[model samples]
Target: MAFLKTIREVGKYFHDIYSGVASLMRGMKVTGSYFTRPGSIVTQRYPENRDTLKMFDNFKGELMLIHDENNLHSCNVCNTCARKCPNGSIEIIYKKVEGADGRSKKILDKYVYHLDTCSFCGLCVPACDELALKFDQKFEHAVFDKRKLTKVLNKPGSSSKTTNE
Candidate 1:
């Protein structure tokens, strides 16, 4: 009985040692793989690699209004994007204009996007029924003043060409 008890204790000690070595090897295996794989290296030399760096197609950086080839935007100024914005980042100001059909229509005067307070939750893009809102890939939006972050989305003097066409 003494011999059997001694053998069992020695077996448990060896088992614990094996488990510890296995855990260590498993961790080292990941490190070794990363060290061997060139593509696994994700360090980008900033400013130097900026010219060649490519952003993914689905990467959402900032909100922008989509203008057609005719320099016309499709926003009807319904204020749906502003209403859906959780943080009051979207501020739209429009004027009621009488169309040729004698119907009063809301024309977009200014579409202000406050990036300083924006959460970028991406709800405003899908909330727009006219597909007017989209995400632009340009991410360099740092500004010295918080008020400068407030941008008007539309190009000046650009009108709704499709509507008038």
Candidate 2:
């Protein structure tokens, strides 16, 4: 009686296996048709056709400091982005200067950004209400040396000094 029950269980297992195989074959038939169709293939040559491609507005690439023609960036050196960066890749040096009202104003000294360690998260952008930071669509950041990856986005001699005090 035990042997008969074991044999009955084995027969039931094969019945289920055949059902699964049939289901798989049905799915494969649809895929096989698509494989033969030229329009169904969805692969793009990225490097060769880069000029024709368009990046999404929200796509996070590289962070850049937007500097005006005067070489002054909108960043007040609040260090909001440096503190919020998860990788500690951003370093903002604050320069103390006398404001027109005779009060000391915290100005951006140097903005050191390490592209190698940046996660490309846009958290740093909105944290700056001054709109000093923005993501540039240019993503070709490869460099031969690691030191080259560390960049100061702000132009030299852009900081204006207030002598009102």
Using TM-score as the measure, the top candidate is 1
lDDT of each: 0.85, 0.80
| lDDT of residue 84 for candidate 1 | 95
Tens-place lDDT per residue, model 2, 1-165, is 999999999999998999999999999998888889979776665565568767887767788888777666677677899998999989987778777778888777679999999988778999887788889777688889999989887778776322211
lDDT of 1 by residue, 75-158 (tens): 887888999998999999888888889988778888899988888799999898889989987768797887888899888876
Top model number, lDDT: 1
Candidate 1 backbone overlaps, count: 0
Q: Quote model 1's TM-score.
A: 0.71
> What value of lDDT does candidate 1 attain over all alpha carbons?
0.85
Show where candidate 1 strays beyond 4 Å. 1-42
Clashes of each: 0, 0
